[model samples]
Target chain A: MNISAKQGERFAHAGLALLLLGLLPLALGPYWLNLVGKYLAFSFVAVGIVLAWGYCGILSLGQGVFFGFGGYAMAMFLKLEASAPELPDFMVWSSVEKLPFWWEPYSSLTVTIASIFLVPIPVAFIFAYAIFRKRVSGVYFAIVTIALSMTLVVLNIGQQGETGGANGITDFSTLLGFDIINDAGKVAIYWVEVVLLLTATTLAALLLHSRFGKLLIAVRDREDRVRFSGFDTAMIKAFIFTVSAVLSSVGGAMFALQAGLVTPSLIGAVTSVELVIYAAVGGRLSVVGAVIGALLVGFMKSYLSEHFPEIWLFFLGGMFIFVVWVLPNGLADLFRKILRVKA
Target chain B: MTFRRGNQAPRRKAVIPAAISIEETFVTFGIFVMQLFNGLSLFTILLLMALGLAIVFGLMGVINMAHGEIMAMGAYTTYLTASFIEHHLPGLMGVYLFIAILLAFAVTFAFGYVLERGFIRWFYHRPLDTLLATWGLSLILQQTYRSVFGAQEVSVPLTTWLSGAWEPTETIQLPLNRIFIVALTILVTLGVWYILHKTRWGLRARAVTQNRAMSSAVGIDTNRVDALIFALGSGLAGIAGSVFTMVGSTNPGTGQLYIVDSFIVVVFGGVASLLGTAASSFLIAQMQTALEYLMSGSMAKVAILLLVITVLYFRPNGLFASKVRA
Candidate 1:
């Protein structure tokens, strides 16, 4: 078959996969639906990692920063709406008489949503421009992003009044005029999350098939060669990085909306590294792989923690080591090989 | 006192900036001196952490995100040692600080060596993979420590000699621990300089770091060099952890606090040069301490990070980066 035919086949397969994903919420119980919702949020971040790290070769260990930004944005709004008659319980207990200046703007849903997309884009853009312009790639790039994540976690924790510090922003009462605690609202949020996940995956697929996407892959594979060929590699990297950051922020916002809380844990280095693991395990080359990897790991996390909390991390560590050793190309490639053999 | 007289008169004159009033001069001079000492003490800890990180990261290009975890390991070792001293050797608890520091370095170095042999060595040139792998390692280590030590902060009992402060004035008392850290940092830096610049092993290590392929072809065991370098780097982090226990609370996740700042210092100092790391540590620490004194902690951290970003923007290779290309 020709290249175009192969591409056509992949799209058909992707559509079928997404159709099954769209029906998952309908089949699962409320508890399972909530788990699935968290999985979707995590998958979005994995997709972002695929773009920044897999496609652009920019190992950004700070996707959590953008993710937390979105989560906090939504959390602030929810907290404001929930505490309309009085101060947030934590803030009140902590002796904060009024909201800080930064928290004031997040009270509006529109502003919160806008910020979910806006905040990460600017951060990614500025960081990418500064680092990429200097030709700082490889380990240096990874270190810088990791440092950024660390700084963010500390900054969040230090701002105890606004951020809720280590306890984080929790006890949200409502989201989008719906009582967040209600079962119907939870189900509604779950379905919305599923739809968003599918939409995001489809959009990512379409984008990756575009001309710019081809250029992006080229830049990743042979950056210097592309630069010599008259392409501005830095701009390409910056653009993709901004897109990834925006997507992660959206994921974070949705996560807060579903879970009704945001914490420093969301933006910490560990969480950022977890996102990378999701992408790596699922298949950095495929967006579908990202979703699959996230859902699988998320489910495993829930199950293992409940059954054997102490050994769960050890299992994860073993799995990571196994994955790196055996399936360096990720699980998606393994599946691809199986399908190829069957065909 | 004889040396103080010559310096005291010059320092008194130096304090007067000629353009400022006496009160303004005194206040500014006082703050400057305070901030300088604060910065130096802060730099002491940062330098200890970054020096080791700089070696491993600079030489191998493996960004060990778990460097902080290793530091935590060191802190935990100190905590355990202090507990042992308290329980068994009560009279010897005062001198236990030295033993704790040494034991922390040894234990963490061994752990680092095993980690390198078992996991890190495989991901030698692949910095990205090393990052993920080490991160997983950090999580495992952190969870293990949590289970072993419990989640609460463990205090390291300070020796009497290192417990008190030097009261320069009623308003300005300097902690002895801080002074000890500064002195320890200088000694450690000098020791590292001696190792990296003077010794035969250091020459081979530098040779491998500069050109891995060529060094290997020239019959140098690059794998052994890699492991030793990692062990040494992590050992420095261990000493840092030991020093930290004297000044702050040691917890399962206390490593997280220093990880970013250490990375900033390492990168800002220039990845490959020990001197660069030390200089950058001093500069960044002083900047952060002064800013913290002036602003809120969060604001100061943000400002320092922003300053780092600005510095990176101007000099991407860092302040003391080698001119070699990849």
Candidate 2:
């Protein structure tokens, strides 16, 4: 069945949109606003996860690679701007006297923004296409993506001179000559991030409601049937995977802008898998729910980790099992059930 | 893969002295032999880890993310076994290693049996969910280890016989521990092969793997097969962990390191083929060893990963895919 919400759910979507863009920012200060913005960055990946895993039957455990592509791409541009007429400090430490060839394209904001999607999309498409074409779905796809993430992490960390090694590329203070590390800058970036998130959510929702969305769900449920109907199931999977990669890429860029750093840890297998749970816990089928899931889980993670560090992993792990066993569709489905009961 | 100038010094120095060239060649050969041995030891570990993973995945189509934790459980069992033996049975020092291996297998096998009943069986057909659920299980297990073991790296004391190196030639010295690990791995591999191929349980497990419905119809007790196969796989990982103590220290996080690599070995070797797992592990271990000789450790890992991914793109079913009706 087509699982998108019916007419009554439209109001709930609007309410969520309004709460995120208009109401919530006014309530939180710069620090919390920045934190929320960070969560919003993850929401991009979560939304992508909802689309890919929730709808398209494509479960990528390596969205962090795309996120890293975007984050590192943006970070490179900002780093160049911050370290104008001199090499980035990490490069200097590693004795890299010359600017790396790849780093050159990232000097311009236009190229950097483009590279975020440009870099990860092709990589994601090729990876997804090859596997999906071979009819490798389910756990094999997930495992391959996990390997990709692991590879990316190692590559990034190994290139100490260029990618800043384990410490990652950080300490940049400005973006396009704008002092982004300040409170006003943080608030401004947070607002932009929220707007971008809203735009992404709208785009994803529209896509999900489209003919392609139907095909995506069709491919998810019964690929052989879809292929029998003369649809290129592999192409469909690759397309959705690329779209999700783009979403994650943008989120990574936004994350770098808001959080002021990007690390190898972001693109590692652990973080990539963790990204799936956000969509999962939020209700993978619901775009808005994934965002809510990102925020809710992100907030819980910060709060729980800060107060009860020992219990945090237990809680997170338990939540994964609980979500899979009890709320397979996540909190959004739970809300839908509650609403249905009332009606 | 990044070009560096550090490792080229030895080859360049080979041009130096007329008589020294012979010694240099001998030294180079020694290094090659040493690296080869290192690769073999690595292959042994990877094979042990991947065998358990491959068996479980091949049979039941369940992806156990907690496979590594199960390995760590084995490692931890070895530690505990060693401590217990030292306290109660000091006279059984040399034989303690053997006892620890058996104990580790028993502990983890029982753990896996309970785990299959309580947790894993629920997500049998749901492979993705199984992956996520087991990941959650892994996290909990890791946390439990940290809580019990206090988060520091723990090691079993190497028996007197396990330490030191065997010198077969003037230039070549092989660590005795690695040789022991290699021997243990071979025995484990043979045991697994024999159990799966020669035993009645193996016949039933294979029957279930090939056709669960048919096997069930024939009264094979598919559920019991799944539980047994899972336990056997886990117990193998425990043996891996036990031998792992000889090579490296065990920590709460050691399992995480091997999990992805083990999965790679399983996938690269073709899912259903046991021989494929062994072959892929050897290929990967050798490639990694060679690369590490030429580049930095991290770079070698990256190169190996890239190579695996590239090879996978070409042969998605892996190198030794079993031909089956789709």
Candidate DockQ scores, in order: 0.52, 0.72
Candidate 1: segments with Cα more than 4 A from true spot: A1-23, A83-115, A157-167, A171-176, A341-343, B1-34, B85-94, B167-172
Which residue runs does candidate 2 get wrong by more than 4 Å? A1-4, A341-343, B1-21
Please, what is the whole-model Cα lDDT of each candidate in the order they appear?
Answer: 0.82, 0.88
lDDT, residue A279, model 1:
87
Which CAPRI category fits model 1?
medium
Per-residue CA lDDT of model 1 for A1-343, tens digit only, reads: 2234355437545654655455565577777777778877988899888877777788888889889888888888888888886877788877999877888887778887888878777778987977888898777777778777877888889878767999998887776677866778778887677777777878887788799888888998889999999988889999988988888998998888877778898998778878888888987877888888898898898899999898888878766666776787687778667555223
Best by TM-score: 2
lDDT of 1 at B28: 55
Q: Write the per-residue lDDT of candidate 2 for residues B127-191, one digit (tens) a residue.
A: 89889989998999999999999889999999999789999988899988888888888888988
- What's the TM-score of each model vs. the native? 0.88, 0.96
